[model samples]
Every structure is written in C-alpha cells, then in structure tokens.
Target chain A: MLLSHPTIGRLVLSAAVTCGLAVPSYAEDILIGVATAQTGGLAPYDQPSLAGFRMAIDELNAKGGLGGKYTAKLAIKDTRTDTAATITAVQELVDAGASIILTPCDADATIAAGQITVAKRIPTLTFCGTAPVLATAVGDNLFGTYPGDNLQATVIADHAYAKGFRKAYLLVSPDSSYTAQLPEYFAEVFKKKGGTILGTGSFTMGQPDFSAIVTAIKALPEQPDLIMTAAYEPDFPAFIQQLRAAGVTTTVYGADAIGTGTVQGLGKLVDGTVYSAAGYPTPGGALEAFNKRFETTTGHAAESAYEANGYEIGLILDAAVKAAGSTDPVKLRDAIAGLDKLPIVTGTITYAGTNGMPVRAVSLIEYKDGKPVFIATQTPAAADVPAPAH
Target chain B: MLLQQVINAISLGGIYALLALGLAIVFSITGLINFAHGELMTLSGYALLAALMMGMPLLPAAVTAVAAGALAAVAMERVAFRPMRGASVTSLLLTSFAVSNLLKVVFQNAISARGKPIAMPDWMAGVVPIGSFTIGVGPLMSIAVSALALLGLELFLRRTVMGAAMRAAAQDFNTLRLVGISANRVIAVAFLLSGVLAGIASLLWIAQRASVDPMMGFVPVLKAFIATVIGGLGSLSGAVAGGMLLGVMEVALQALLPPSLAPYRDALVLSGIIVVLLVRPNGLIPAVDTARS
Candidate 1:
C-alpha cells in the first residue's frame, strides 16, 4: 500500500535514479588543492579552516556545482605547519592537477606557497596570512581573504582614542617579527591622535614568567589607562593573568592575535580587555545564511575571524571559477581581479590592484566578562604611519 | 620592589629546583642524564589530566600521576635502559634520546587529537590578594610543594637505611655490590624518587599555566639541564643551590633590563653561566669528592 502511494513511489524512483546515475555522471570534476598545516603548531588555525572549506564545498555542490557543469573536489595535503612541509605540500597539490590552491595559515608558509603559485601562474588564496611584507611582494596570483595587520592596528588606535585612553603602555615581544611591528604601528596612530606613550616593556616568547613586566608596569608613576600588547596566543594568557595578579587592572587592548583561543582560554582573567579584529561575529544577508549553514555542516561554532575568512575564501574561489567560465589559471586570476565589490562573510571586499592591498573593513570587539562582544564596524583611515627605514 | 623580585625569584627557583633534583637523583645512581626525564614529567602531567577528566579529586589525581610516573620510569629501566646498561655511554645516551622522542611523538598526537586545553578544577583559579600585591595561588602552591618535596627527599636520603644504600651505590655501585647490596634495588629506588619529584614538578607547572601540552616539558627540561650543570653535575645540594641561583638571576635580569633587551635575557643568562664556569669550571658548588681529580 505504501509503495503504491504516488508520493512514496516518486521519492523511491528519484533516490534510485540519483544513486544509479546522478552521482556517476561527471561532466567535469574540478580539483581544488588545499595545502594547510593540519598537524603542527599551525593546526589550530588550519584545522578549523579545513572544516570551513569543506562546508563551503558541500554547500556549493548542493546548489548545483560551480560553472553550472563541474563539481569541486577538494584535494587536501597536510603541510605539517612547517615552511619546508608547506613547499612540499604545494608541489604535491600541483602534481595532483589542482587548478586553484589554498595555502597554509601563517605568513612564512603562506608566502613560500605564494611564490610557488606565482611562478607557476596558479591562483592562490590565504585565509589568515597578515604579514605586511607578503602583501607588498606577491603579485596578482596571490590574494588574502583577511585584511592586513595594519588595519587591525589602525582600528585599535581609533577605538582607544574614542574611549579617551590618551596614555598607553606598549608591551611587545622583541623576538617576534609580528609583535615587533605592532607597537610601531600603534605608536604612529596613537601619537597622531595625541596619545602619549607612558612607558614600554618587553617579554620574550616562550618565557612563562610575566612578573617582571607586571612589576615594571605597576611601578610607573602615573598608571596608563590602557595597556596595548602585541603578543601571540601562548604568551598572551600568561601576560594578562600575571598583569592582573600584579594588581595592574588597566584596560588592555591588542591586535587581532587577541581574538584567538589562547585569549578565550584565559577565561575570567581576560575580562574587560578590548581588541580590533578583521571580521564581525554576526554577519548579515548571505553571510548570515552561510554562517548558519556552515555551523550545521561543521558541527562546531564558526565564531573566529580565521574560520569566517576560510569560508569567504571558498566562496570567492567559487565565484571566480563561475565568472571565468573555465578552470584555466590565468582566466580565474583575471576574473577575481575584476570583481568590483564582492560581498563576503566578513564584509565587502574589493581588489584594488594585483599588487595592491584588498579593501576590507575591520571590526572592534570588547571583552565583557570573558566574551568578545561586537562593538562597531569601521573602515580604518589610510595609515599615515611611516614604515621604519631600513 | 626588592621583596617582590626576591619572592618571584624563589618561586621561579622552586620549579627549577624540583626539575634539577629529579634529574640529579637519576643521574647520581644510573650515570645517565635520562633525557627522557622531562618526558616523564610531561607524561605525569598528562596522566593527571586524564585522571581529572575521569572525575578523580585533585589530591588523588596528583597521587595517581606520581604513581604513573614512577611506574613509567620502572618500565623504562626494564625495557630500554637496562638492556644497554653496560654498553658504551654513547649507546645509553642514544637510547635515552630515542625514548624521549618516542614519548614526545605519542603525547603530541594524543593532545592534538583531543583538540582542547586540559581542564583544571575551579578551585585552582585566581589570586589570593595580600596587601598591595596579589599572589597567584599556583605560584604560592608551587613554592610550598617544592619545599615539602625537597624536605621529604632530604629525609629519605639521610634517615632510612635504604637511603644509606642509595648513597653508597651512587658513590660506588661496584663497591656496594661487593658489600652485598643489590645495585638494582638502589637504581629502582632512585627512579622511584625521581618520578615522585617529576610528578610534583608537573603539578606546579600545570598549576602555573592551568593547561598541559606535550611541548610543556621542553623548557622545563632545558632549565633543569642548566640548573644541574650550574649546580655541580653530580651534587644534589649543588642542584638545589644552582636552581635557586638561576631563578634569582633570571628575575634580576628581567627587572634590570629595559623592555627592548628582554628577548636577550636568555643569551645574557647563558653568558653569565659561561663566566661562572670560566671562574669555577666545576660549577658554583663542586661535588665534594669528585672535585679532587
């Protein structure tokens, strides 16, 4: 009786056909290469990006494959999160006939991959590479899904000026290339806004003790209203906890690194700190729909800027493929460069030039009771900050 | 500022002291650096994490961790170290390195697969305010536990007859064998004591960070090596003194240097060690008998 029902019969016939023919008929299988550090120091960033990328791929396939003909097949190679591994992974992906390649997380690995892709004339995208030098060196073949680190510094400085924090203590890690540049950027912005640098302190990476820095900060004659640190995840939590333990409860602010799991792990100790991030938590329109779909597919929260950037990178790549009408490397690159204003999960992204930085918006977030609450979205003013002379 | 720096130095020193003491005991008896010693500490930390996850209370979890460390050491001696006991020093050293690498890989995979920071209980969080400065309970507990462990170790090495046998074996295992003492027993006791010290160190290290990762042992072990070398290589008292001295020097350097020079702190400390070694090649406190030749 159930089999005889019209609706049930139609469903059975559709399932049989899909199983027998629909999946087997491959008009064209477009292979996209992903080289990421799935198992090393960069695993935290890479693993989540992998999840996001898969979610995007699944959604794209469900919506009738890219270019209205080919279904995307993501071939992933683990870079082991090392520079040497990243190079090898990229080579492997290229060997596997990947037309478009997604590179690893950090600047060094991403840059290395970018060089290879550029030499090979393949289109490459990075989800979280923010090294300023990379953006300047790489040409049109390379694109970043996230805003540059300069935007993060500008946003923080603007937010701090708005909050009446005119006096700031800058703490940076001299050993880190990333951290070293942050204070310089902040100093340029804060000084321009008429904020005084009260004092400066430094800590070494991998040094667990922060008491000395905390003691020095406490010893300042007039306490600064804000403490701005440019530190990585492992060091950030220790620095904040020790700063609080030393009875220095000054409002803390930092660059995009503050928006990582390391800060989240600090729990209540991270309360009352604010930072500038490249992406917003609650995206609108298509992004909102994508986020919901991403969460359902990934079975984890897509809350981080890195995850959003990864998802957006997938969407952009899909769009470029569709626009190019072919998987040809040069055509895809040209199509991507020609996009005037592509709305992504983060915000509107416009590629100014092949060598120029992409125009992207930044968001300011404040940590209230250990959660990064949305504050305001603002496009940072063009940085008037001069780069340090060689 | 002086008092705070001194307190910071002592607390930092306590961690080093525990690490060095654990290494010292094993080296004194086995004549091996036991490169795997740091990994033992890491293994104990992970064991404690596992125990905590299994709903054991803090104190019981700590005890289990210590037991696990001791058992792991015993197993290492039986399987790896014991086979190459009388071989060239190079063979034993290579075996230790191999053991360390194997453990590191296993722990790294285990931690990564879990993909979360090892959780600590709620009671261990926050600071206990005292006067103008607030001290973290973890650091305070580290100092206290290290002191107690050191005291207990001193008592065990001096008071018990088994302790006398251990000392004799360290001095001359062959002579101890002639005196009808089992060298195996002495070696086992040394491993057990080292495990206990490593377990205690793991607790303090975890308390300070409130998380455990496989790479956690790398720095601690390096510090321990430095402490042992700065302390007379074979002297237990030297280990303790050297650990305290290193901790104080590190804090002092941090306080004195400007922020820009902070990254060079390690280089500066190593330079100081070289100067000390140049002045006293046998270390700050040379081993009493070994210094003669």
Candidate 2:
C-alpha cells in the first residue's frame, strides 16, 4: 500500500531517511500507561492517582530508570471515570506503544480497562479496582493492588467483634450495589461470628432525612452496641451526624468509602467515626515517603485510597517492567503473575496467579478528634470471597 | 411502617411543592418555565456552602444564598428571558435550557465540579422524635419552609397591589396593558418571586442530603415539572397540592414494594400519573376559568 501511493511512498522514504539520521542519538525509554478518572465524581480518585504515578516515575528516573537501560516515559490519559472513557484510554495507550497499563478509580472502569488489556495481552495493575466480580470477569490480565471489598467487610466485622459489639444496627442504601453488598457480606460474617443484627433500615440515595431510619434504630428495646453502615462518603457524614443527633451514641463503623476524602471533606463531623481502610498516612515510611514525593510534585497531600493505590500500582508496574526487561505485553503479564512479594507503600503486594487479584492486609482506622488514627490490621482468611447471592 | 412512609412522602412532597411553586410562579406570569430553576436552587445551596466555608455565620450564609439566588434570577431575566420577550414559546424554552446548561458548567467549574455534600449546620444535623416516628431536622425544615413560602405567596397575591397586578397580568396581559400597567414589570416581579422561592428551596434541599452538585437540579426540576403539570398549569394552590401528593405517593410506594422492585419506584409514579391524566385530562385541578377562556 505504501509503494502504491506516490504521496505515501515519498513520505515513507523521507521518514526512513529522517529516522536513519536520528537513529544513532536515539535512546530507548519504557512507556508506562495510566488510565484514570480525571473528571466526574471520581476525579478525586483519579487526580491524586495521576499525581502519585508521576511522583513514582520521577523517583524511578532519579534512581536511573527501570532495568538500567531505559528511562520510564509516562503516558497518562483521563478516563473521566466512565466505563467507555476507560476503554478508550486503554486503547489509546496501547496504540501509543505502552508497555503496561495502570488502572485507577472505580471498579467498573478498571474492569473495563482490564478487558482491553487481556485482549491485547498487556499487564494491567489497578489501585482501587476491588469489586469481586472483576476477578471472574477479566480473569488473567487484571490485577488489583488494593485488597477487594470482601476483605474490607471481613475486617469491619472482625473489628466490631473484637470491640465486643454483639448487636449491630445496620444502615444500607439499596441504590448502590457497593453499599448494599458491604452490609450483606458483613451480616453473614458477623452472624457467623455470633453478633446479632438488632435492626436493619434501608434508605434510598439522595434522601437527606434519616429520621425514620434513625428513629427505628433508636427505638430498639436494647440499643445496639454498634452501628455498621454501608454508605458513600457524602451520605456517610450526614448519617453519622444524624445518628449522633438522635441520641443513639452507638459507635459508628463504615466501609471503605468512608476512608476517602469524602470523609475528610466532612472535617469536624468525621470525628470519632471508625472506618475500614487499605492503608494509613503517617510518619516517614513508605506511605509518608510517597506522600512527601506526591505533595512535592502535585501540590496536594495524597489523602485517599485512590492515591495510595495509584502510587503502589506504579511501583508494581515498575517491578513488572523491570522483571519483563522489554515492553512485550506477554512477557509483562508473565512477570506480574509471577510476582512473589512486591513491596508497595500500602503493603507487601502479591498477585494470586492469573486471577490477578492482590491479597493484602486490610487496616481499621478511626477518626479521633479530627485525625485518622490506625487501629488494627486484619488479613482475611481467604483472599477470594465468593460473590454474594443476588 | 406505613406512617413512616407517609412522613417520607410528605417531606418529599414538600420539596416537590416548593420546586413547583418556584417554577409555576415564573410560568404563571411570564409563560416561561425557567429551565434554570434547578440550577438556581443549586447555586443558592452552593452560595450558602461557600459562605460557611468562608467562616461567615450560618444565618448570614443562608441570607447570602437567597440573595445570590435572587441576583442570579435577575441576571437570567436581563441576559436571557428579557431579550427574548414576545418570542415563540419554543424559543423562550430553548433559551432557558441553554441558560441552565451554561450555569451548570460554570458552577461545576467554580465549585467542586461534580456533586459534593454541603455540610449542614450543627443545629440542623439531628432528628426530632415524635411518638413512634423520627424525622430529620432537614426534612422538618423543608416542610416548614415550603408551607411558609406558599402561605406568604398566597397572601402576597391576595393583599399586595403588585401581587394583584401580577395576577391581573397573568390572567389577561392584553387587558392589563390597556389599563396602563407595564407587562415587563409584572414579568420581572414573577421572576424575582420565583427566584426567592428557589433560594428557599435550595436551603431545604441541601439540608436534606447535606450535599450539592451541578446536576443535582435535574431531578428536582423534573419532579417540579411533573408536579406543576399534575396540579394545574397556572394554579399555585394546585401546584402545592400536587407536589405533596407526589412525594407521599412515591415514599409510600417505596415502603410497600419489595426490595427487588424498589428500583422501579419512579416508573410506578409515572404509571400513576398516566392513570390520573387518563381520568382527569386537565390535571387534578383545572386552571382558573378567569385566567384564560
């Protein structure tokens, strides 16, 4: 086709000459791709991840790039936190010669990117893609750096059990599958652990009034020991505040969504609330280092799970690229699957074979007088919890 | 459970009523729906939030929010609705929609882009227990505010000369023109009144969810439109009644339905509307006979 078209032929001849002229000075660089939420409701997740990824890449380059032969060149695209945008971002990265792709933000978006990566046989690592369905959905190519939601639920239940909360009041939103599943998962385990569910109340999303639900909880003959809620950050604070206002002083516990900036966004309202988290932000270790480097580069502190996941996934991608030695997708996939003990700021990340799901320790953190304090770390007995019944 | 559902419905209905009242006032006099009504509410909520963030007192913050909403309404009249006076209804509707979109984009950029929960004041954060049921202060505030706004509006229409003139203009602009009252002034008053209603509604809305987003106005606007249609197009009393009825029906249906069928709540509401329209044809209350033919 190039030879048949005169314009193409002339352009190809000129390109070949130009390449030949510059070939001696050209140096090879490993291209790493990032597909993350840059806009939408998930921008809080994606923006920080992008910052963390860049900081990690800059640090690696300062230490003399991956494999000592190639400097890492980061290619980032805004997924807009939508499924279609995520797929497009991955395809664009693959088209632009990315060796490996990084997934950040929502589980659905990450899973969508995983499908593309699997088709292209590229090694893809995600920071916050924790929906259990993604494991069976994307199979081999998808790997999560953060522990899945199952671990989060287990950690919360165990923490409650350890705290001697025998009866728990559960508040779940039926609108969100994420919020709905957490309570369902916790109920099963909490029951197994011998905790009685005192009361269960349902609320639809966007209903600001929780008086009926709160009133219901408050009327329980013997007040529950704890309030286990599965709700988004926006709803979580309001729910917590209302619960406090209703004179139900039962200690409140929440799922991973509460650990996000949405909780921090609550400021003083977030005090005394305990929530499950993947990692902690504190004094000078890996996380602190990551935070310092991230803040230096991005002008903001890494305050949420998405940022931690993104920073850690970048480290994972760097390791896989170093192990693979080349940008070949097949080699990178094999290298990632074979990763035995990759160290991340969050934890010691290890992939569970072709499932590509990370099995890491989950942390329980509480907001004490307006600051997040790490409470305990719990490891799920089983890394892969079966999907809950519909 | 049924009583709780009833309360839920009332709170929701009250919000819908306020939204409808805001939209209906504009429609009644100006004959334009002001598609930006939802944004006006959202902008007010954000203004209150911005004030709170700026360390202003809550009362001042709330006042600023209403003032901001009113100012925005005035701006809308000056920049969008006023210019297109006497144009086709379709053109006016399109202009309102365009203004809504522009405001949404601008607000998203200026504030947190997507929806972020606006924090409630410490005073508005809890529930008041009444007998067996509990209700959030936010919902109570919503119901109280809507009732007061509607009552004040009804009195305004009855007692004030401007309000009387507005009713006259809405009933027959041509006749009012012959009487030497400027049609523009009456229309502008309508917009201002609607803006105040929207501003008040914004406070109630943010109080309920404790959050505000750019597109948050879409659902409220849709509910308001449905309420205004179900109630009569030009009747304020009908709009209030329709909003409360819709809210109560929605919450009651939600309480009655099984978990598996909960997602179909909006569908069930629409189905009920279809049945009602089929029976009434001209809404639950007909427009005042004196207003038109």
Candidates' DockQ values? 0.27, 0.28
RMSD in angstroms between candidate 1 and the native structure over all alpha carbons: 7.3
Model 1's chain B yields a TM-score of: 0.94
Per-residue C-alpha lDDT of model 2 across residues A134-201, encoded as one tens digit per residue = 65666677766666666688888887888888998777776655666778788778888899987677
lDDT of 2 by residue, B1-293 (tens): 45555665677788889889888878877778778999899889888878888999888998999888888888889888888998877898899899988887677556655456566667676667789756566556667777888889899999999999988877777898899988878887888888888898888777766667766677788889999888877777878977887887776665566556755766788899888778877677766642431
Please list the Cα RMSD from the true structure of every candidate, rounded to 1 decimal place: 7.3, 6.9
| Residue pairs that clash (backbone atoms under 3 angstroms), model 1 | none
Model 1 chain A worst lDDT run, 10 consecutive residues: A17-26
Model 1 residue B268 distance off true place after TM-score fit, in angstroms: 1.8
Clash pairs of candidate 2? A208-B208, B9-B248, B117-B211, B118-B210, B118-B211
